[model samples]
Target: MANNKSAKKRILTNERNRLQNRFYKSSVRTLTKMFLNSLEIYKTTRTPENKEKVQNTLNSAYSLIDKATKKNVFHKNTAARKKSKLAAQFKTA
Candidate 1:
């Protein structure tokens, strides 16, 4: 329990930030899953449609991660690593 006014405000702010961070994390995971699924479909089908979908998903995921890093939801190196891994997946596919 926060007895002081400032402490109460801090607690409220922390809750707000926590929610925002959770949203960012959940979105990133969802995007990553979508991208991976697209990769799998592309692997089996090898169609231009699948390639385009994969590219679009990758771009979206990359954009989100970079933005998250900038907003401090993710660390810079972590974002870089994720971006690198995603690019590698596309290349290998």
Candidate 2:
């Protein structure tokens, strides 16, 4: 329990931040999964349309990740590592 008014406000603020962070993290994961799935489809089909889809998903994932990093939801190095991993997978595919 919070002992004072300030403490109560702090608790509420922290909870709001936590939920926002969770939303960002979840969105990042969803976008990453979408990118990977599209990459897989491209690998299987080797079609220009599939390749374009993969590229678009990759760009979207990258944009969301950068936004999360800018908002301080993700550490800069962590964001870099994630982006690197995604890029590597795309290249290999």
Distance from true location, Cα of 84 in model 2, Å: 0.4
For every model in order, what is the number of clashing pairs? 0, 0
Q: How accurate locally is residue 15 in candidate 1, as Cα lDDT from 0 to 100?
A: 98
Q: Give a tens-digit lDDT track for model 1, residues 1-93.
A: 989999999999999999989988899999999999999999999989999999999999999998889889999999999999999999999
Residue ranges of candidate 2 with Cα displaced over 4 Å: none
Highest TM-score model number: 1
For 1-93, candidate 2 gives per-residue lDDT tens digits of 989999999999999999989999999999988998888889889999999999999999999999999989999999999999999999999
**What TM-score would you give candidate 1 relative to the actual structure?**
0.96
Q: Model 1: runs farther than 4 Å from truth?
A: none
In TM-score terms, candidate 2 sits at 0.95
Residue 22 alpha-carbon offset, candidate 2, angstroms? 0.3
**What pairs collide in candidate 2?**
none
lDDT of each candidate versus the true structure: 0.95, 0.94
